[model samples]
Target: MREAVRKESEIFSELAEICTSPGYVHAIASLCYQNNILIYADKLTPEDMLQQFARDILVRTEVSTLIGLACKKQLNIDLPSPEVIQRYIDKTDSLLKEIHQSMMLPMEYIFDSNEVSDHNFNPFRDGLVLREPIFYSGESAYYFQYRDLSKIKYEKDNDWFLRNKGFSIQQVIDVVMSIQSLQNDKAKNVLRGLFDKNPSEWTVLSAYKFTAKEVSDISNIEIDTVRLVIESFVSSIGMDEFNSLDDFNPKNAYPIIQLPEDEYLLFQIYSLTQALYETPFFWFNDDKAYKNIANQHRGEFTENFSAERLKLVFGEERVFSNIDIYNSKDQVGEIDVLVVFADRAIILQAKSKKLTITSRKGNDNSLQSDFKKAIQEAYDQAYLCATLLNDKKYKLVDKSGKELNINREYKEIYPFCVISEHYPALSFQARQFLKFQETKNIKPPFVMDVFLLDVMTEMLQSPLHFLSYVNRRTSYGDKILSTHELTILSYHLKQNLWIDNKYAMMQIEDEICVDLDLAMLTRRDGAPGSDTPEGILTKYKGTVFDQIIRNIDKLEHSEIISLGFTLLSMSSNAIEMINNGISELIKRGRKDGQHHDLTLEISEGGLGLTIHCNDDHESISRPRLENHCELRKYTQKARSWFGICIGQKVPRLRFGVNKEYDWVQSNEMDELVQDLPKPQNLEGKNKINFAPATRQSKKVGRNEKCPCGSGKKYKKCCLKQEWRM
Candidate 1:
């Protein structure tokens, strides 16, 4: 078979070249080959041999052509002629009419053939009529199937076998059926012969089967239904109409599976599972999904400080590791831990009671409020934990009058104590609070994983799938709003509808479960009065509006605006910095409260002020504050103190200083120098004197005229006028 196929390949190659030149010689040669005119090999010219070879090539190359040719021969028709094509078609129609007239005959033919087959005793293989067909072992069998013979229909006739005319559906079916019924050796011979006789019809048949039944279940159904389903399924596949069997379910006639008794849906289900299982797994580890998830599980944070402090430094690597020293010292409340070399001490508070919340009877949203309260309590506990770790003196104990001590000797000693999911909302809140504190230069030690996990769980409303969302937006980040935060926002909005929350609906498959309601309820206030779009966005904007706050610095400072707007927005603790700056200015004893008008005050060299002060009574001296003022003195000391004055009628200064500084004074007031320094000490330096020189009254000559373009007398144009003036 291999040798024959190789020879056939060579013939086809020649035929390809012959096809390029469509002359009668090549054409007739091709036609003779198409007709399978293989004469005695020793009695033929090269052209005749080539033609005979081409005929064999076309006959054996395809299954449908082989079957068609057999049909033609069975009906006793010549190849490559109009009459032969009609006869082949007629034979196919007659065969189908005969089969439909007596379906039992075909069934009996199948039964008798199977009984003689080797595996006839097996129930699964043989009891089912089409499960095991006597097919020639080949690669094409991978896609081959026992198709229902009755379903095929030709959309159009493509009969190239009988001199370019076409064969009908019945003709092709009959030919294929007859081919299938032959014995293995006889079938091969018949197929080779049919290929020689009707190459085009066989090609069409091969193409039809090629198009049908990709991944289908056909274990049960009536024969007629099977025929329709198989026909539709095959046609669908051939035409590339739908991408998957899932799409073909609704269109088929036989409920898709002809054999309905078996668990056919299981096959489709398994197929779907395989598809999902085989999907790329790059997301498991290094991908954002994994990283986001993995970071939630943290490890030891070994930095420069911890590296130097070895457990063995004090002659024992296991110092306190096996001991329960804190267990004996059951003193409750806060304890201070010395940081050795640092001046700061750490505070540890023992929280005796496990943090929990209670609902108030008057509140309609007691459950929700309690949930948030618990979360905040947890956050505070975590922050307290961080504070203890950072300073080494704080601890929390549950309500059982139990003293909980965090031992530094343990490997898993996180900055915060472990809390339950009941306080989930607190995790993110606590994290944000700690971050704010850190930004304010407060040192709070928190486990990186604790912070990430807590924040992730709260924000995502899912357990720690830390790896999943690390590189993607969490629900919190999705909209400037969180669906979980909407409940709180609803109360603020004075509306009961928390209905348009989509993030709450997300199905997150992670370990930590969160009540998304808490997330959706948290929202910022709206803008001042107007309910415009800008107003709404402004209203909802929280600390995230820091960009706009920074921009506000560009405006002239108004004390009322600073105190009422800026300070009111800032934390009370943060106002300490502003108060200290203002106090330092006040102690200098300059009055005029010019510093109160922060815009002018900043221009006058006080730290640019805003209304962020805690109290108005902190300052009383206004007139004395402006007494030391000197805006632009040109003395050596002033010049040395300020850099070169550029493009101005005022003294030099920095970006923060303006022309208004002339009205403000420094505490260090000194006398201005009147006499200029002598050149004897400043020759190499840039110092210059403005004193007049000698020989200034010399007379001008007549020809020494001005160079101006007036075109007047040399003395009158410019030089004479200068002398007279």
Candidate 2:
């Protein structure tokens, strides 16, 4: 038998194509007219279909606009009228909302409890770190370390820098004022004097050197308040909060140690200051300390996010994240996310790089370099991980480095690079590169832009459909192997079994088991006396019968006979039920007697059933007909009974009765008798006549013929007409 084919999403692909065709649009319009739905058919032209609808449809326009904006305003398109655009935008937004509501996964939200710790930098113990020198010119009155104060003024110019560092302009002002309010009158006056001299010329360490007593003498404020104010100002700059004025010295000071809240505020100030002082700050800079940290966190977030999305789409059991694969040679690789289906594996590599179109014309050298590097790195890592999976000897481990034992082995692996940002030109280039790689026999990873990933998570609910889409997009080879076939292959590979022999044996066993189970269910005598074994067997002759007969040599004879008997027992019970329901026929078989001669026997490479009786001829033959008819009626309701006999011959025989008991004859009986071998003579014959009695000495009437079909009159023959009534 030919194997069942795997289901494909060809219809969806075809629909996608048809949706873009002008002819299809026209046909749809025609359908609307036929249905009496008014449409502006005359206004619909090939150009209108291609330009007006194709390019300007609500969903397409909204998606394109999003992509364009994401790519740093690189994409250029003609704008439609505001009214028309707004209408489409609203429609698109509504559709998206509906889709999201329908497809969102029902996952329980979990709260993270890890606290954000403080980070601080000090010029003294932490070393004077200058991101870039504020001034490189000849020496001035202020020392180089004091120039760090220049950052404070620069922070006021860069709002975005502050926001990125987790702060607001108001928060910054509040923190500064809070520190100022802690200072006493004398300390405040000293601060004012320092600012007037040159706010950018004084370092925190230098301010710490001025004694509170000197400040108190200068401003005539309380000495204790001055000391408290000086200590508050020092602590604000990330100094030891409990340090004594006598122990503190500008020459030997502690490193800046920021408290959790203070660290966050200071980092914001420092970042904003750097941004404002620099000539230009590249948004996509790879070297910045904060950017590097952000990228690490973002990459982790992307992996987790992708895993969750996959879990929603495919279920949690099928998705594994941060899987580590290592060979004996110590070559190691990690998969960001692995989605395993019954027969396919999807390996995802999440890249946190911010992709942008540096050149509108798509010829920017730096953009091309960055895109290629990212794609290549992701692909190489994915390929390495896939290679490990291809061999059963190497196991893929979870994040904790514990081996994962997946029951199913994949026939196909789809590697995808999921990017954080949209870069249309780079994406197109990546696709072309992948296509080129395919020619070289390397299955390159597909580039999944964030938008496309979102859409796929919504659309491909089934893993089979997801794999089908991947195959179509990549021009992968035809999907000829079934899930069962792949399962067998997996077993063979894992067990190191001979492929040809084991696969064939497994296939045969599978077929036999399936056919046997189906036959049993349909032919069994269960409640609802609606079906019979014989009818079911006959219906499945071409399919189930052919399979059994072809593989009979491989199957055990006892097994087949057991199945046949099981079917017979069920059928017999069902027949008895039907007999009870019939008012005309009394059932011959009894529970107490154990004399049911109904036998299901294997003969001549087929199954046949025989029934016997030792009663009067009429009682035996008439009941046979009733039983046959009743069984046939129930069997008619059955599904299939391919290997069992349901013909008229199997039910017509009578054993242990004399030839005189042959009172009924039909063409069906003749055909059945001709097919069977010669019957054995009975060992003990006790024939009892059951014909209705007649008056033995009745006088013959003149015109009546013999009752036995003789030509002579009743007086001439041994018949009496008066006996008929």
**Highest lDDT scorer:** 2
Model 2 TM-score, all chains together: 0.31
lDDT of 2 by residue, 1-725 (tens): 32332222232223233333322222222221222111224332222223222322322212222221222211122233334334433443444343323222222211112321323321211101110010111111111111132233223434544444343333333333232232223233444565665533322212212344454555455556544333322222222221211112211111112222222111111222222222112332433755555445446655766777677667888899988776764647888999876546788998756433332222345444566566767877777777667677666778786888884355567788876443433333453333223322235466664435644454344443344445534442222122122122222212211222223322211221222222222333121221222333233345422232323222323223323222222332333332222211113322122122232222222323333322333433333434332232222222211122111222212221111111244454443334223211111222211223233355446666433222335453332322322
Clashing pairs in 2: 536-640, 536-641, 537-640, 537-641, 537-642, 538-641
Question: How well does model 1 score by local distance difference test?
Answer: 0.25
What value does the lDDT take at residue 407 in candidate 2? 44
* TM-score for each candidate, following the candidate numbering: 0.18, 0.31
Off by over 4 Å in 2: 1-287, 355-361, 364-367, 435-444, 476-725
Question: Candidate 1 on 413-459: residue-level lDDT in tens?
Answer: 12222221122233222332222233122233322212122333333
Best by TM-score: 2
